[model samples]
Target: MNYALFIARKIYNGGDNTQKVSKPAINIATIGVAIGLAVMIISVCVVLGFKHSIRDKIVGFGSHITVANFLTLQSSEQYPIVINDSLTKELKTIPGVKHIQRYAYTQGILKTNSDFLGVVLKGVGPDFDSTFIHNNMVEGVIPRFSDTENQQNIVISKTIADKLKLKVGQRLFAYFINKQNVRTRKFTIAGIYSTNMKQFDAQVCFTDLYTAKKLNGWEADQYSGAEILVNDFLQLDPISYDVLSKVKNKVDHYGETYSSENIIEQNPQIFSWLDLMDMNVWIILALMIAVAGVTMISGLLIIILERTQMIGILKALGSRNKQIRHIFLWFATFIIGRGLIIGNIIGFGIIFLQKWTGLIKLDPQTYYVSTVPVEINISLIVALNLATLLICVLVLIAPSYLISHIHPAKSMHYE
Candidate 1:
């Protein structure tokens, strides 16, 4: 906008407010806009932060991708799992690949004291990623590879341990149904770990790969599918595609094309629920931006109304209409930009505070965590900034158009 026109617009918008709208009204309007913007921005950041944080937890516990046996049975019976270890070794060379471990998990019953619970007994080799539960261990130790024959040791979840009143070095009997559907063998309690997700922690128990092999009666070379731990969880889609190129000689589950997914796909419903939350966050974000933009538009219109007479004088004094629009544009945009900055400050401040202090609480029984998790998506914030700014500019078109219709002759001669 032209500098002179902009100044003219501002003066006209102000309209000698001293004699018209009292300073109190202007203050209220400014404060109202500030509050609305702050609320919207903060709401968006908080909700999105929670969604992203939960996803990272899921990824850290499980990898970005897994290669497991396809569900071929329709009778609701467990299927036999086997993977091509040669193909797994070849797939590990793909870029962004980190580590691959063969795993076999089966539903088993563990008996400890007065309690009996079902758990996913994971049979893993020495190469398993210990970091997943390294920090999450709240009691006992992690599942150590048994060094002796007939070791019969296992790691249980904290939830299970508490319910059963069992501790480390206690004997826990595990019952596994073989391919023949016969109960065979028992595992001892060597360690206990918790991921804090009761849904997961309560059900996941761990043991060595050799034990799973003995139970399944598979040959030395046969085992269940592989869990592919990646350098980054976000690389799942791209790496999964590359995986198809390498694992063609092996089993193909998706239309004869090996797309990544494993026996661990049992938790699809939980993940689907998580994805729903992601969509909810985005929808809330869109609504917030709209609410903030709408409130600012109302403020600008109020400012425009109070300046009608000044707009007339400027128009009569030979100032072009386009220049007149700039003054109001600058005023409204400046206010919005200021509010945006303030909102971001408060939003991120709250996130850090909650992260350190855990001031916000949620019911772990219902929410899976004791406090809200905050994970800022920088790209999301940037997109929100641009989007809100653009909406403000576009909505400004309405009241600003009122500039062209201002009749200076009648205004200077009349009120």
Candidate 2:
């Protein structure tokens, strides 16, 4: 049986009243740790939540990656590329590839009685993933696509619809600017969606791929580009390279020569803004850890002072300095454990509450999300707990050494 652990538990449980320190000081330290941990947890939730929310909006507007002819560099222009069965099969085989869909965009203007808006008419094939659009649809239904029959349905953003005074089932005229002259088509408003991204929402309108092909004067087998979705956004770089290499290898037979562009590389400015959040998170984490460390240090010092008489008694009994240190360290560990447990409960409680109720509101213009978002990563929580425990224990060790300096005669006689 380990006597140090046994004695430490006894003191912690207050079964041995003589070994105890002032309750108030220990309570204050524990509260300090709880507050620090709570702040850290909330900060982590907001930062990661904001990062992912912005990323999903961008990906929804574009895609995780784009496979297109090298000439189709800008969103406004398109050079038709055929994504044949062989090319699709090869792309699917690449690890982490989620969904592939044909997409094409043309520059156009929407004209209503009251107003007009310059919009990019983005054409999507039947296989288009509409999950993001459905989630963010403020009103009406997504434009339905039929392979055999032409569907002239269009999905516009509330930002555009409101400005143009357009409504669902309303027939509007969209004029496309071509090199030769101008082309006009009648389109029905099928839906209104809002991604809360002002720039993307203002500039884009969705329609069927057939309409885009007809507008571009392309054949049935051709598409401006293929949008590729990946299972993991973090693995974009490797997956993009793998996809590019696979496409290159198949180009000999399939005649599917294409270049891949990662979502990050495509919109460098917005991603750069997201990257800045990491620095802010790191700074918050360091500050919280420092605060917790200082609180633990103060608590350990008090515990030592309160037990100076016991330290002397133990020393006189021939207890080694290391063994006595273990006793105090164990006591400090108990205090930290209590703080962490209570802190986790309080912190997670707030997180869950906000997640369910959305009690916190954010400015959509500034944050790109109406509600304050949160993400609870189990691995991150575990790492945080371990790091805090380890750092606090290490910090207490320096103060624990003061036990060795308490001379047996001086401590015993004075107290």
Candidate 3:
């Protein structure tokens, strides 16, 4: 009963070979669609993967949110704040708050006989979640920290290690200037990790909280700040606001006011750079879609012209212009559908290959990742396919009008 689709199928199946000229245009159009879609898919996946990887790396160094003293926020100095059990309990009550742990910082210098490096000794208590550091460890295991004892074990980054020619299990003396009094402590490196983030890797080293507290001359129950982890990063702002409400204007035992800031606020430069990648992806997508649509339109016009005799015969047999238009539209759909299938195969093949084998590599120093990252979002892929198909078909509608303008008598004579 659907004569348009029936005719479209017969023509698509090469029922008529007289339109040999159109074959080349059709193939070019399909190739154009396939390549454009593949490029779009690859662009989206790469950008998203880059964003996710970089965000995690930053968050791993500093948690989702930081609650520190107002003075500490102003200056990176470890101004003491008291995080008692009661305060911890109150913060844990806030929705989306996953974990809370005490942290402190002391700027010091690591010295060996061969080289010396400036570093920040980040002190974490027994409650510190070592998952992030553990995952990135290259040389040794993350040492266990205890609140009762000053464990002189520390974790250093590979960048610092390579720079200073230091290794895990090596004894290094760290010197800190406290109130113009130079103090020294000997620590054994327990682990070496690399996140490929030069900012953190070159400067930050992890040590037990007690050791950092002693270095800062702080008493028990005193810390520089608390790092808050949230269940979902999307809820970070709301959770940070909730935390600020609990601690804002409230003084610790030392009379220090608490200030809360999310990871994005702490590192604006890096996040802003990451945000720019989205713009790049949008531009790529727009250009690729335009290229594909143009090709499809051209191919549709050629196919309509080549089938002029068929159009005339159908019109003479009492077929309407609308019905004839549907015939070519259906034919265009078939071509577009075939291109989509090929594009999806090619796109996903590259994505999976890179993801599994890391066949393509990037400079860690610049990209913050060793290999090209790709994230396959099924929903996004499906949406892209649907949108591409719809847009190409819609663009071909005007060209399909050429079929309507073909006079039956004239088209019958169209060679």
Task: Return the lDDT, model 2, position 365.
Answer: 81
| Preferred candidate (TM-score higher): 1 or 3 | 3
Q: Candidate 2 on 294-360: residue-level lDDT in tens?
A: 9888888887888888888889999988999999899888888889888899989999999999999
**Residue 158 of model 2, lDDT score:** 93
Better of 1 and 2 by lDDT: 2
Residue 91, candidate 2: Cα error in Å is 1.1
C-alpha RMSD values across all candidates: 4.2, 2.0, 1.6
TM-score of 3: 0.96
Deviating ranges (above 4 Å) for candidate 2: 74-76, 248-257
Q: TM per model?
A: 0.83, 0.95, 0.96
lDDT rank order: 3, 2, 1
Give lDDT: candidate 1, residue 158.
79
Better of 1 and 2 by TM-score: 2
Cand. 2 Cα-lDDT: 0.85
